[model samples]
Target: MTHLFDPLTLRGVTFRNRIGVAPMCQYSAAEDARPTEWHLAHLLQRSLGGAGLVCVEATGVLPEGRITPTCLGLWNDAQESSHARLAQAIARGGAVPGIQLAHAGRKASRRPTWQRGPAEPGWEIVGPSAAAFGDYATPHALTPEEIEALPKAFADSARRAVRAGYGFVELHGAHGYLLHQFLSPLSNMRNDAWGGDFAGRSRLVLDTSDAIRAVIPDQMPLFVRLSHTDWVAGGWDTEETVALSRLLKAKGVDLISVTSGGLDHRQKIDLVPLYQVPGAEAVRQGAEIPVAAVGLITTPEEAQAVVAEGRADMVLLARAVLRNPYWPAQAAIALGRPEALVPPQYDRGWNDWGKLPVELAVAEPMPAL
Candidate 1:
């Protein structure tokens, strides 16, 4: 059985541990999308705490695609340069730096989650149709020309991420975002070639991946995050994600990070340990592609079991890492292999933790306020 701290390689990239920090957004960037001090501190701390791969949050390809005015952007040289510092910082702390390229689609033009209000002032929200996401705001439909231009924007951002020293890039196709809006039947009411059937719906993401892969060198890996199930009836489901995984695999996607929901307003999620692992397993089995299982995966033994059982190739954590960035290092002690995930900087801190109570090792307060 491969332990969570074991090194896993894909293409030319090697992750020191199977543990990865899922892209969690910090809506603190400048209006022009430059990385603030907050971005550097948040990601660099995770690396120091022993995460193998640290993925920066959803960075928009174009200004209009931003979910918030303060979201990161890679559309220009200055923005790329600013993020390069962050990438270097993460690498210096012994973690592979990655960026998730995204376009919010109809979910654009919103205030950051911290801000409670009507939509941000003077921002345009775009989606596949003129549908209202919730009772919050109205979204404008995209024209055919705009749809054609979107892929080029994504490719452009991928190039910038590579230039910024990202070892890997994940195209954000999950969470009812732009690429996802095109894939889900409930959101995409288009009768044209971009919708109606599964092939047409998946075309946008596949073509975007192909364009991005063309620019990025083969040494750098690319992954796609898929909402494996929309959690609503007659919407994007497990079967569709399996097929999408096959297409993404052919387009040079190294892994599929399986997440679910965010397409419907009425979704009832079952919050439990390893709840989303099955989706990753299905994609891995049905599509013959590697998968990264996410959602409430909090323990080393549980993460190890997911990999050992062939359910997923990697285990991604968002809230779990936020709860304890040093979870990977602590996990090493729990599994009786303290030398693996522990860096030389933290060697002194590794005192017979294996003998300590499990509750004491993981009883830290939440990082997020």
Candidate 2:
């Protein structure tokens, strides 16, 4: 049986283990959307912490696509150069560097959630329809010409990612973003070819995936993050997500990272441990593609069981990882796999751990990035 620490090979790239750091936005970028020192330190530390794959957060493909002015972007040379440094830092710390490309669509032009107030007026947001996401501004409906241009925009950003030295790329088709706006009927009320039935709804995502694949080398695995359900009646659900996964696989996507319910305010989710694993299992079985489960999987045992029991091929940790960047190493020790990746500087600390009781095995202080 595959365990959490087992290496996973997809296409020509192999992740050292089945543990990944789910992309979480820092919302701390400069006005220009370039990665700052915080990004470099945050991602590189997680790499050193022993995650097999360290994914940069949702980076915008266009300035207008950002969820906030502070989100990272890859549309310009400066941004691309900044990401190259981050990629190298992740690699140097012993993790495969990955990035998620996204467009925020109707959800754009908001203040950071921490600011806790109304968003200041900014650039117009665009989506499949002129619908507003809750109280946000009603986005302008995208024209056919603009819709046709989206794939090229995605492709261009993907090319920049390749140049930035990312070994893997995940398209953010989830979380009520632009692609999810096109996929979910709740947000997409368009009657054109870009919206209606499943085929129409899935066109933009499929086209964007194909466009990205056309530019990136076949050896570089591509992953897609999907909101497996909208958690409301008559909305996008697990079955549709499975079908979309199959289509994405046919278009050369290697894995489906299953996350759910960010498309609507009406969504009713039962938050619990492994709440989304079943969705991953359904997609993996239905689409015959590897799936990475995410959501409240905090402990080493829970993460291990997800992989070992064949529930999902991998598990991605978000808040848990942020709470403890070295969670992977601690998990490795607990699972009796002490050979897991540990930096040379930290070798003495882990060596002492074997002689000490579990409660006494404290981690050494991390060095400056």
Candidate 3:
């Protein structure tokens, strides 16, 4: 049986432990969509704090696909270079560097949460259908040709991620993003080949995965984040998600990061601890694929249980890690594996008697050469 601190090997990559830091948007990039110093600091710290896999946030494959003007992107050379630096930093800090490629669809072009209001006139948003998400402007429905071209766009982004030295790539098909829009019948109301049936609706996601898999090395792991449920009546739910997971697994996807909701405004979610683990379990059992569970998984014990009890293969921490970058280290100590992932630079921080320093480490001035 696997535990939280046990290593997980997917394809040719091995995570040092099962504790991964979920991608959280910083929304601090410049207009050019390059990662800023904030990203380096934020992601590197998580790696140094002992996360097994430090995933970059939902990065736009196209500029217009960004959730906000400040979202990070990899659609250009400069952005690729910036992400390369981040990938190196995560590796040097002792963790696998992964990235999530996304297209926000109708949810694009919104202001960051800190600056919420009407967005300045921006590029027209595109989706499977012309639907407005809540108060957002109606997006233009993508033409069939545009639909055909999307997989290439996603493939191109995966190429950039390989160029940037990412160990794995995750296709963001969840949280009402472009791919999720195609997956959910509620958002993709169309009568064409790209809609109206399960095969039609799932075509984009499968094609994108195939395209990405073709470009990346065979050994590189590919993950997909899917909203297991839309949480509204007549919306995409666990059954379809399971079917999609099976298809993706056949197409070379190694893992499914199961999350839920955000496809519809009328979503009714009961916010409780481990509320989403069942969905992950359902997908894992139905599809026979390794899965990662996320959603209010705060404590080390809870995370360990999810993996140890075979509820899920891994647990991703978001808010808990944000509050304390050293969450994994603390967890290691709590689980009686204090030496599991302590960085040598901070060896003094942990002792055999469960004593831990309040701070990770203090840098002393270098002696004069």
Worst 10 residues of 2 by lDDT: 356-365
Overall lDDT per candidate, in order of appearance? 0.86, 0.91, 0.91
Q: Give candidate 3 misplaced runs (Cα > 4 Å).
A: 348-369
Provide the clash count, candidate 1: 0
- Predicted candidate 3 versus true structure: per-residue lDDT over 1-369, tens digit per residue: 888888999999999889899989999997799998899889988988888899999999999999988999988899999899889888877789999999999999988888885458677899899888888889999999999999999899999999999999999999999999999999999889889988999999999999999999989999999999999999999999999999999999999999999999999999999999999999999999999999999998999999999999999999999999989988887787753466656666555446664334333232232
lDDT of 2: 0.91
lDDT by residue for model 2 (51-164), tens:
899999999999999888899999999999999988988887778999999999999888888884335767889999999988888999999999999999989999999999
lDDT-sorted candidate list, best first? 2, 3, 1
Model 3 residue 75 distance off true place after TM-score fit, in angstroms: 1.2
Instruction: Encode model 1's per-residue lDDT on 156-247: one tens digit a residue.
Output: 99999999999999999999998999999998889888988999889899989999999999988999999999898899999999998998
All predictions: root-mean-square deviation over Cα? 4.6, 3.0, 3.1
Model 2 CA lDDT for position 229: 97
* Clash-forming residue pairs, model 1: none
What is candidate 2's CA lDDT for residue 303?
95
